[model samples]
Structure formats: C-alpha cells, structure tokens
Target: MKNKTYVLVIIALITLSFSSMAQRVDRTNFKAGVHAGVPFGDISDLANFEIGLDLGYHWALSELIDAGLSTGFMNVFVNNDTVDFGSFVLEGDFPNIQYLPVAAALRIYPTYDFKLGADVGYAVGVNQGNSGGLYIRPMVGVNVGRSTEVNISYVKISDDYDFSMAALGILFLF
Candidate 1:
C-alpha cells in the first residue's frame, strides 16, 4: 500500500509539472546573422581576420530551451602575400582558409533578455586543398529588442590542425 501511494504521488507531481510547462506556447523561428573577428592561436600566423553569415532554424523545446540546426560560412583572410617564418620568407599568393560549419545548436534562456548557447558539429572545408574538421562554438547573447539579438562567441575548428577566433555577432529573427 505504501509503494502504491508513493507511485501515485509521483504521477500527480509530474502531471502538475507538465501542465504548468504547457502554459506557455512557443512557435518555431528563423534566425539570420553576421559576424566578424580576427584569427587567433595557431591559425593567426596564416590568417588575418574572418567574417561569416549565420542561418538557423529553431523550435521551442520548452519555455526557456531552444533546439536547432545551425550553418554558416566563414572566411579567414590570408595575412599577406608574403609570409615570414623567422628563418625564411616565401613570397607568393596563398589561399584564404575558408570553411562552412554545420552544427547542432542549443540555447537556454535564463531570463527574457539573456541567453547561453552552444553548437557542435563539423566544419566542412570549402576552400581548395582544404579538408575540414570538427566544429564547436559557445556563445552568450542578449536580446536587443523584440526581434533582434546580439551575441559574442568563440569559434573553434580542429582538422589536421586546430584553429580558433573570437567573434561578435548580431541576428534578426524571422
């Protein structure tokens, strides 16, 4: 009898929880954004800066959680036509390191105006002779107004080598 009573209590609590969670209905949304930043760490020696466009579709998993798919294009510009490696200098054109990121994204809204998020997936090398690698980004964001958001993020990709950058981005939701 005690075991059955405990089971009944658990089910009652769960039902109440779901009913409260269901009070707020959220709709699917689209996000588009752009960002620019300078290359840092290992790739800094080979590249100057990067700019990218972000596109994503998100569905509300709960009142405060969003799950989505994210994709973006990034181009890291070559530093110079000539590169110096301390002991030697070579002169010629070098290709910019360019890649596209395809990732699973999740964001949590701690408050109506604040959010934290992350993306993990693969970066596909789109530049000639470039093979892409794993992609990861963690971000913090602020809601600017009704339909705009501003965010700062760290971008990292590891292939045969690890490359990273710091970016500030803005988005318009539709």
Candidate 2:
C-alpha cells in the first residue's frame, strides 16, 4: 500500500513536469472531470448498482495522444440474488465496498471529440481484509462540448472480478 502511493506520486510529478514544459501544448485540452455510473455484471444482475465519484485528469499530448490519472471509489455488493462472495450474496441489501484506484492512462484520440485509452493502476479497498490489488482499465470517451464528455470503461481488478460500466458526465479542461 505504501509502495502504491509512492508510485502514484511519481507518475503525478512526471505528468506535471511535462505539462509545465510543454508551452503552447493546449493544456486546456487537458481536462479534469467527475463521473458516476452503474457497473454491469453479477452486481447489476443482482440489482446492485455501484455508484461513485471519479477524479480524472487528462493531458492531450497531441491530436492523437494523451495521458492522465484517475482515482475513485468503487462499491461492490457482497451478496444478493446472484452468487455470493464468501457467505455474502451481492444484492441491494449488501453493503458497497469502497476501493481507491489510482491509474495512469494513455489515450488515442481519433477525433477532437473522441478518445480511447488504456489505463494501468492499482486499487486499495478501504475495508479490512479486502486486500489492495492491481487493476487495468480500458476506456473510451466522447467530448460533448465545452468540458463535458461521456465515458465507458472496462475494469479488471485483482484477477478475481471484472467490472464494466458507462458514465455520462463532464470533463472539465483546465
């Protein structure tokens, strides 16, 4: 866990330096945004929705390339109508587990308003015994206009579970 935070700090420093040095680099095109969405899978099938906030920062390296970081909360149901995790069945009555994920992303923008990105990072569950884990996220987004876009992402965490979700929200470009 300590190592994970250190790595995230290093990545943030590198990105910040690059941003500062690249004058004329449409940094405004780089953006920060918040997101919330329902995950699909056994959780959704069980009538459980994982809702959380996303703090995303994106830097447009070029017309076609970009990089960024995202950290957020994840709520997973323990038990419900579907299979159970241990004795818990992920359902509406189950509690949402909060996981803090920090990821570095590389994005390819085919159009000024559209992008596809691959994200690599780590996640730490706040609950005891939940174990922090490695994760990868593949995401796509479409810029709606003026710092707003809709995004969808596929996430694999800990090699134990896969999460797929779509978020409709705004990307605030600084």
Candidate 3:
C-alpha cells in the first residue's frame, strides 16, 4: 500500500541519518523493542490489552546518560461486548484506539545493568475520529545480556480523556 511505502521510506531515511551519527559517536546504538500492556483507568471498562513496537537511536551523552529519538506504534483493542462491574454495567462496540508515538528518549544508568528513563512526546491518532494526544512513559530497565534489556513502564496518552496503562517491554540493542 502507498501508506506502508511512505512509512518504509521515512524509516529508511531516519536509519540512514542515525548511521551517519553513529560514525562519529562511539557509544551510539540502534534499538528495537516490543511491548504489551493492560488498559486501566477510565478506559479499563472500554478496552482490552495493547501491543506495540519501539524503535530508537540512542547515543551516550556521558558515561551514565543516553539520549535520542524514539517512535513507535501502539494499538489498544476495544471491548466489543458489554462490560459488567459489580456496581453497574456499560456497553461497548467502540472503535479500537491506535497511535503513533514520537518522542525524545533518555536514560540514566546508575549501574552497568540498570537504567531509568522516560519518553515524552505526542501520539498521532491512527483511526477515524481520533486526534491523539500528549504521550509520556517512565521506565525502568535491567540488562539481560550484552544486547538485550527488559523494562517496565507506565504509559499515559491524554487529551480530553486518557488512554493509560502499565506495560512490560524489552529492547534489543545493536
């Protein structure tokens, strides 16, 4: 599809740019990751789970800090059947929520295998009648190997209403 082609082209361009930056930065690396989470808050009754991918370029700013740009896709599946709580009942049949997250990434390493970071940016809506909103995720990670890291993060995407969750993710560095 034309839309897929456009996204491929953009990703290729960004990868090319990061490759050039890597030539001058000894600590730079490319990372790709996957995440999944359960919907909570006001949306808990309306949605199920979400899954996504994270791709980024991270370069060391100092021995203990890393920073770069990050973008990813996330999809929140809508609950199509009516949801019943002990106190009341609500209906479903709503459209799924999806977004493209574009944000700045940063990490602080306190030890060789431990890090803390957050991504702050905007989520571009990918479905009809959705305009998206501000996105923020704070995360903590532990290295599993030289090239793999596992992390836990809390995600918030808010506008008039909020689509929030607690997620677990993993990243592979190259």
Top lDDT: which candidate number? 3
**Residue 11 lDDT in candidate 2:** 100
- lDDT digits (tens) for residues 17-51 of candidate 2: 77654752554544555656666664455434555
Show the lowest summed lDDT stretch of 10 residues, model 3.
19-28
* Candidate 3 stretches greater than 4 Å from native: 1-28, 83-92
Predicted structure 2: lDDT: 0.67
**Residues 1-174, candidate 3, lDDT per residue (tens digit)?**
999999999999888767755643664379999999998987787887999999999877666778989999999988898877658886857788889999999999898699999999999999998898999999999999988999999999996566889999999988
TM-score of each: 0.84, 0.66, 0.79
Model 2: per-residue Cα lDDT at residue 107: 83
| Candidate 1 C-alpha error for residue 82, in Å | 2.6
Ranked candidates (lDDT, high to low) = 3, 1, 2
lDDT of 3 at 19: 71
List per-candidate RMSD values in Å.
Answer: 2.7, 11.6, 13.5
CA lDDT of each prediction against the hidden true structure: 0.87, 0.67, 0.87
Per-candidate clashes come to: 0, 7, 0
Clashes of 3: 0
Which predicted model would earn the best TM-score?
1
Ranking by TM-score: 1, 3, 2
lDDT tens digits, residue span 1-174, model 1: 999999999999989766755652343379999999888876887787899999998877777888899998998998667766668776888888888999999999898789999989999999898899999999999998888999999998997765989999998888
